[model samples]
Target: MAVVGSGVAGLVTALDLLDRRPELTVALIDKGVSGESGSTPLAQGGLAAAVGPDDSPAMHAADTARAGDGHTDPRAVAVMAAETPARVADLRRRGAVFDTQDDGSLALAREGGQQVGRSVRAADATGAEMFRALRDAAIEKARNGSLVRLQGMVVDLPLATTPEQPVIGAWLLCDEIAGGMATPSQDAGLVLLRAQAVMLATGGCGGLYAGTTNRDEATGDALALAGRAGAALQDLEFVQFHPTGLKSADGRFQRFLLTEALRGAGAHLLDADGNRFMLDRHPDAELAPRHVVAKAILDQPGGAWLDARMIPDHQLAEEFPTVLTGARTFGFDLATEPVPVEPCEHYMIGGVATDLHGRTSVPGLYAAGEAASSGVHGANRMAGNSLAQSCVFAHRAALDMAARLDGAHADTDPEPPTFGRDTPVTADGSERTDLRTAMSAGGGAIRDADGLQKLGQVIDDLRAAAYRAWGGPKPPMVRDALEVDSMLVSARAIVDSALHRTESRGAHFRTDYPDHDPVWAGRRQRVQLTG
Candidate 1:
């Protein structure tokens, strides 16, 4: 009855639930406007689907598993790959117009870790186009009164009054930030929204890092909320870094991502001396898996850059207009100049543990998108798979939730919700900054035992300080306060999982144990926080 966040998963889940059971009361809750928020709009790499004549779901699955490093879930990968084409078609039906070839076929582009071109794109603004269609559809559904939109966040999962269910609703914290009115008191923003079920489509935690491509809103609230509610968070160590983030000289512009499709369009990776170097690192070179290419760039002594000047100006204007305009804003021209590039935190592969259908360990609880660790991408995610994974799993979760409610006494008109009171822990700004710095230095693209140990200690100290502030009279629960809490808990879980996994595998690499261990294959580290 309640879905959190408003990305592809959140929107589609709400839509599909209405499709299956027309009588259900669905509340689509989000911290921003239902359609314009979350990381889905930031997805520029496009969605991976088997649309090429030579491409197939089997090949897509193979590439997904290979990018996953060593421990991706086989069943989840198969489901995502098989269902992706249908999801793409659904997007098209919803009004997404992708670029097409001369024969009017979908324009499939190749990215890293792919054997062939299979990712369908809309120039370089694929995510924007997808979000536009999804947003319009969601808004139309809202107009028809199929679902009501709540501009707020769910702080905790509360239990039902009945003994039969463990968690039957959510605790919301609304504020003026989303144009919602909170209580007169600063520390009084809790409202109990009891429902038939609760879904978390809140996206990943990339905003926790100092150098990340995620928006400021992406603070891993789902991971923090789930861990506190006794749900297991799995594979917390495998955070993926994108290989090409714009880093211009003189620091004039802030960092932004250069989509993998740019490289697929015949761009080159150049060393400091303007010589191609990716070929020496891997057979696929610029098209190699993200982890290999990211690591190679970090290993460069002077630094690396992306040379897109070789790409035709007309093609660049048509296919990479967004990228070109963005680059020009930072004093670089993609069609005529080379731009400095480096790896930055792009995606989080680990998240709240969930089954293939988005059901978490807790009953009546589910998750999708980057928030759910479905194990489809074991160690790392290939470019564009996040969009496909989100769409596929959200549809499945919606179908399952609808089946559970069909003639099964689901509360269509739940009792009017009430308010609850509590002292929210104050966020320590200085400690928050230290946490990000420590995470970036110790648990970032490369890791070692010493660094992870230090990072763990930093998290422990910050967490203790954060809780100590909750003992006295409570202050207002500001946005930064919520984000800092999320950052601390998430940072602790990630570092703890990274420390537990000794061997280097996938996106998680340890300098101490640089080789893959046969004993660790098909294995993963899961964390369930008690505090």
Candidate 2:
């Protein structure tokens, strides 16, 4: 069995599988230096749970449902919220750490869309603490031979090429850039991996946008691979835009996201004229739901700014050392300066449609975390809920996969398939840059039919170029070609999903159709790539 990605979802799922079924063989594949490049470690807010005395799973579910704008799956939200405490406990047992108050109790903080303080954090680096725990465990297991960690990119989903088909494994691009042993010349080749079951926890496609908090490698490889393999995607239009991404005056720090936790701790949003504007827009002001804050910021002529001076200098330095250091490195002091801020594409609320257990439309295939649309996030994810959902769903998926393995016949292991050669397609680096620009302009925070149509044309042209390269006589640069291919596939999906939903809801705001259509109320949009 193999799991693609090494983020919180992939690591937890892989570890769970190995722990439960010791005899099972598992291969873990990651595109970047495992555990360092994904969105998990970049997360600053803590995980949300109902462990506080004033909080309950029901309250958490209500907050999630409210933020989701009626599109979140009730059952899925209930499951995730209920499992939060247990999942946090599980991580604690596995060496994860969280911030504590002076009384020795777990410290809780609040973010947008929450009624009370229910987020357990590690000062401000909660994601990093949790990821460290999981990564350390996986590393230990890998050393013991219970797991095989492969540093490479999965270029394609080899099996499940058609609807309802079973997935066996993936085609991987092995190269030094991806941490594999293969050199960067024509000698670099493709490796076909065949496993009994394959799971994609490959995060989201935030990198498709020109400005995103997501890592550069988060190019939506899993979504595109699933689309090519005939898997269904849901709610692709609902892309979450975080309200505060740091932009320096000199442009040295362009895409660093000033964590939302700062606002939760009382930081304010200031306009170009140095006026606190959010107070007039929403009652919660800086604590409004992310979509609301992002839209408000985008509406400003000079773009919105952040006044971190609202938080004390000592608090800024101790609580958010990473953010403070980044600001200082760029000559901006978080405790005094009015840092320029803008919304950046942050998370994807939609992905390969899957059940709560992570089973997709195809058999022998599963997805979790941002890669899978489990409907816990619905249209817009509440802050801090992402890590919670990833951990809980990853646990469920692992158990389901293990159960499947136990029920399989004694000859469950299939004969290894022959390695297949890949026809490399040449891709221009400039074209990749163009694709990001097009996606940001069309499918970003604000959209309309005209821009979306233009974006569609761009994707069509790019797809044609990729196909031409795929069929050409020369051996193509497979990795570059695949990245573009995946971006094109993902871009088209977002556009199509946006076009299909004629109403504005949550993160998806249509300029032409500004009002939420009653027709779309309580309904979720879905799309599949067919060509």
Candidate 3:
């Protein structure tokens, strides 16, 4: 078994599999250092679970459905909401530390679109704390030799010739293994690890946008690889725009995310004129669904500001030490002044289409986390549900894989795909910058026919240029080139999906067709690659 990401989803799957079958051999592959890849550690918000006295799975499901704007699959959302408490408990038992109340019960926080406090957190750095726990557990497993950690960049998955043919393995590029170069000359160093089952836990495609909260590694590699392997992707246009991202004094870290917990704790959103504006936008005010709030912020003439002056000073220090430190370092006090903010590409609501068990259209291939669209989020994601969805579905995938691999019932081992000394795409940093700019300008918080068409043309042009470079006499595989290729591929999918869906819903708001169409409510837009 091979897990392609080292985030919460991938690690949870690997660890759960090892726990179930200690003798099983699992290869944990990551694009970065094993425990430090993807957007997991950068998560400022917490995970949602219906463990509060006033909360229930039914209530959570309703909230999830409302947030998704009627496109959410009831079954998938039910599974996540129902299993959340158990999953949180499992994490707690495995050394995850959740913030506790005075009585030591799990302290919960609220966020946009939630009716109650269901977010279990460890200060404002919930993802960091959760990753620390999971990472420590993985380190233990590695020490015991049940798990092997491989650090490398995955360029492609080895798909079979037939449409339904199972994937046998993947192509991995490691600096040490590739003799310090990813070119075809170092093909000997490019190792192919065969496995019975492969899981894609790679995170979202936020890197496609110029303004994003995703880490650089989140270039939609897994989504692009799956698409190239002939998999169906759903709802690519439904990119979730977070309502509040911190504005950096210096241009360097301007994309840093300001967690929604501040708003959940009664913070107000103010426009540049020092006016409380969200009150007029939605009845829920600061707690309106993410898409609504994001649009309001984007509508601001100068910029949006988060006013947390109403939140008590003691609570700010105790409940959000990380956010406080970050704000103070940037010369803003959360307890005193208003922090500047903007809308950022936060999560992609669509991804590799999969069932609840993580099985994709292609056999022997599975997906989970942000990489897989299990239909739990539908058109829009409820706040704090991303981490929960990742954990629940990843656990389900691991269990399913473990059961199938236990007997000879698994598909027979197929021969790995043969590779030629392939020419890799060439690097041009400007191409990536241009792609991001176009994606943000045209396909961002709002989209229409003309803008989406223009973005699609840009993607086509950039893709053509990349392939031309690749066709040049023996180009070696460069990381930057591959990243741009993946970004372009992912961006195309988003543009195509946005173009197909003419009506506005969830995060996919179109100014030209702003009204949500009842006809398209139940129907999901899917995209696929065909020869």
Candidate 4:
């Protein structure tokens, strides 16, 4: 078995697989250092689950369904809510300590869209702490037996000899950065691995948008790779824009995400006149659903301001030390001033369509976490639900895979493909910068038909240009091929899906169709590449 990506979902999946089936052989691959690929490491708002007597799984599921705008699958939501408690307990057993109240019960806080206090956090650095815990557990398991960790970029999924045959494994292009070339000096550029099953936990497609809280490596490579290999994608148009992303005066540096937990802890959203604007937006005001808050910010005159002054100074330093410290790094004191904010691409509500057990349309392939649209989040994802979803689905996928391990056969390993190694394979800084700039300009928030159409054309042109300059049977072409292919696929998917919706719903707001159409209510737009 092979698992791509090394984030919380991937790591948890591997750990669960090992725990369930100790004799199974698993190889975990990551492009970067294990645990740094997905937004899991940067998650600030904790996991959302019914951890207190005051909160119930029904209420949690209702909020999830409501936020998803009636499109959430009830079964998937039930599975997530029902299994979340055990998942949390498992994390605790593995040394993940959650913040607790004086009475010894878990400390629960509220975030946007939650009707009850259900978010379980570990200080302000929830993602970092969770990553450390999971990473350590995976490493310990590997040391004991059976798991292998590989650091390299996956170029493509190698299919069986026949068309639409089950994916056997991946073709990896291991480029040598120091000498700016491929290995073996002349040929043998691609390395092949055979696996009985493949799991893609490759995070979200947030990088397709201009302003996003996603990591730089989030280029939608996994989604594109899967799509090219015939995976069905759903709800691609339902991209969630977080309202409180830290924005500079010039609107640059939009990656910083201010967690909604701050508001749950009594912070406020103020405008330029130092007046609370959410009061006029929704009854819940500062704690309204994320889509409502984000739309409110978009409607506000000059974006919004996150006011951290409502909380006490010492308490602020204690609960959200990471956020406080990060604020200081940007020359601001959170306890005194309001942070300038705007909505950026925060999460992709849609991804590779999968069942409750993380099984995709194709056999022997599974996906979990942000990479898979498991029908838990629907149209708009709740603030703390992502982490819980990752853990729950990872466990499910692992269990499902373990059930099939006895009969699973060794994949027929095919001979490696050849490529020219004489060409340079160094990371092109200029190309990377260009890709980022283009995505930001054409695909940023507030996109229209014209902008998307033009963006698609430009991306196609860029892909063609890259191929012309570097494509010729060389290993260096692998990065160019992967990056361009992923970008084009993502752009096209978003644009096509956005065009089909034709109505303003959830995170998708079209100025042309300013109001939600009753006819489109209860419907999800699915996208697939036509032959």
Candidate 5:
């Protein structure tokens, strides 16, 4: 089996497959180095699970449903919440250590939308700890010949013998940095490997927006690849914007994020005059659902700030070393200053649609992590729920893939297609920066119909220019094809979905339609490419 992406979801999926079916050969592919593409490594908040004695799966499920604004599938939410405890236990068995209280109970912190303190963390760097453990486990297994780590970018899913047949494998482009140089020799060109099943855990589409807490590789590659292969997609418009990204001096840009965990730990959101703002906006104040808080911040005049001064310095240093260090590096003291903040693209609430078992519409294909819309985070996502969702669904996908392999089936792998010999080279350093700038400015937190329409046109023009520059009639090499195809497809999807959803709901707010409509409630709009 083949798994794309090296995040927590991909690594766990691979490990689960190895444990479940030791005989199956698995290949794991990633665009960057292993453990780089996923937001898992950058996550500050911990996994949201009912690990406390006072917590229950039902309570977790209810919080999830309520946060999603009634669009969440009850079955999916229940499945995730019910399986969360076991998943946490599995992580512990694999050497993941969650922070514990003085009384010997698991330390649970709260985030937006939770009734009880249930977020399990590790020194405020929860993602780093999870990534390290998962990566070490996967690497050990890979070294022992249980799995293969393909360091390359996946271009497309190669078709099987028939259109209705299961997917056999993917076409890959091998590109890795060696000796501080990016070598693009033909020896590192296209490669094809047959697999029993394919799982896409390729993170999220956060990079499609201007400002995001996601890493550079979160470019919607999985969604675009699946869409090109005709997979079903849903809720493309529901992109969650976190309200606390550090703002730049210009007031038009944002830097890295200050996690929602700070608020859960007693920090407050204040206005420029040092007045607490959330209390006036919502009864729950800082503990309100993510979408509500984000919208409130956006609506508030002169923006907002996060007051972290209330926490003791020694305790802050102990619990949030990452944030504290980052603040120091930027020449600021978190204890004295109210951090300037604004909403930024924080999460994708929708992606390639999948079932409870991680089965997509396409045969022999499954997905997990932020790339798959399993209906867990419907219209809005709750803080810390993403990590739990990834872990639970990764195991589910692995089990389903193992089931398919155990059943009697004929070999369906087909000869892979070849790209043109004279494909255009991918962007150099300067060109890549330009592309990012264009995407960010044209598509950001605030959007108008005109800007979105113009952005769509710009993407189309860019694609045409890229095709013309390539000089050959056939598609370019896997790397170039993947980059161009992903950008074009993602841009089109976001623009089309934003245009279709005429009401302000969740993360998708239209200034043209400033008020939410009852008719638009509880409904998710699907997007597909049409002639």
Candidate 6:
């Protein structure tokens, strides 16, 4: 079995699968060191579970559906909400440590779009703590030879010629990226390997936007790879712009996240005039759903501010030490004044379509985490569900895949055709910046037919440039070029999906049609590549 990513989703899937069937062999592939890749380690918000005394899975499901603005799939949301507690407990048993109350009860925090304080935390760096636990377990497995960790970037998945388009394995490029530059060493080349099952747990496409809160590695590689392999994608347009991203001077095009737990702790969102603007925008004020708060922030004339000075100094230091450090890094003191913040692309709500068991349309090509859309978060995601969804769905996917692989299916599956690394492209590499700039300008925060159409034109132009570059010669398989190629596919899909739906819903807001349409309430848009 091959797990092509090492984030929380991939980690949980690999570990859980290994535990379920200890005789099975697994290979974990990633360009970054295991456990540190993707958005998981960078996540600050805690996981949401129904473990609180008064909370239950039914209540969690209701909140999840409400936050999605009536677009979430009931079955999928129920599964996620129900399984979250078990996953959190599993993490804790595996060594994850969370903050506890004075009596040693689990300390829970309230976040946006929740009726109760059900979010579990590790001092606002929850994901890091979870990853630390999982990472340590994974290292032990590797040392004991139960798992193989391969350092390589997966560039493509080998798909069969049949109409069903089953994937056999993955194609990897041995490359390196450092300080915004990609260079090939002597060993840098391509390799094709077969696997019983291929899991795409790669994170979201936030890197497609210019001013995103995601790191540079989130280039939508897995999303594009799955599509080209004939897997269907859903809801690519519903990119969640987090309501509060710390303003940065680093200018790396990536913004650090200011955890929503701040607002949950009574922080305020003030406009440039030093007025609490969110009160007029949503009934919940600063605690409104992410899309609501984000849209309201964009409406501010001079921009938005996160006023956390009202939070006690001790609380700021103890409960949100990450935010405290982030604020000071940008020369702002959360205990003294309001800090500048903006809405930036945070999460990809939709991804490669998956069933409740995490199977994509293409057989043997399963997906989970930010890379897969299990329909749990239909149009919008609830706060704190990202990590929960990742852990829950990945576990389900691994269990199902493990059972199938244990049967004769792994050997009886039709073989895919011989494949190689995708033909590379050559250019000065301005296409990447151009694509992100256009995506952020036309696809960020707000949308309409006109802006989406213009963005489509830009994607088309870049596609032409890449096609022309591919025709001329086989260029080096540089990481930047590969990422840009993937970005083009994901960006075009986003524009197409954004244009297909005419009405506003959750994170996808159209200026021309500012209200939700009853007709398209649960109608999910899907796309796949065809020859």
Clashes per prediction? 0, 2, 0, 0, 1, 0
Model 6, position 29: C-alpha lDDT score: 75
lDDT of 3 by residue, 1-531 (tens): 888988999989999988887888788877875445688888877999999999999999999999998899999999999998998988998899989989988899998889999899998988888898988888888777778777777777775566577776777776454321111123324677777778999999988888898877789887788887878888888999888888775644366787999999989988888999988888889999999899898888888889999989899998888888888877888888999888888998899999999989888888999999988998889988999999999999989988878523234444543332365444547778889889989999988999999999999998777667767322245667768768877888889989999899999999999998988978987788652
Query: Candidate 5: where is the Cα deviation over 4 Å?
Result: 176-187, 251-254, 407-442, 472-475, 478-481
Every model: Cα RMSD to truth = 3.6, 3.5, 3.5, 3.7, 3.2, 3.7
Candidate 5 residue lDDT tens string, 1-531: 889988888988999999988877678886776555678889888899998888899999999998887779899999999998899998988888889989977788889989988899997889889888887777678666778777788877866667686777888787744411111223476787677678998888776656788876777887887876778888888888888888777755555788788898899998877788788777779988888888777777887888899999887898888887886676567888888788888888889899999988889888899999988997888877999999999999888877778634436655665555464654543333455566666555556677778877877776676656555434567565556557667777877888777777666777778667888777777766541
lDDT of 2 by residue, 414-504 (tens): 3322321365345457667888888888888899999999999998887776666667322254566667767777888889889889988
Ten contiguous residues minimizing lDDT sum, candidate 4: 179-188
Deviation (Å) of 110 in candidate 3: 1.0
> Alpha-carbon error at 241 in model 1, in Å?
0.4
Task: For candidate 5, report its TM-score.
Answer: 0.92
For model 4, the stretches where C-alpha displacement exceeds 4 angstroms are: 162-164, 175-189, 407-411, 415-435, 472-481
Global CA lDDT computed for model 3: 0.84
lDDT of 1 by residue, 399-490 (tens): 99998864333443334333212455444477667876788889999999999998898888877776666442222355566677778878
Q: Each model's TM-score?
A: 0.92, 0.92, 0.93, 0.92, 0.92, 0.93
State which candidate, 2 or 3, has the greater lDDT. Answer: 3
Off by over 4 Å in 3: 160-164, 177-188, 248-253, 407-426, 472-475
Candidate 5 clash pair list = 210-440
Q: What is the lDDT of residue 133 in candidate 1?
A: 88
The CA lDDT at 276 in model 1 is: 92
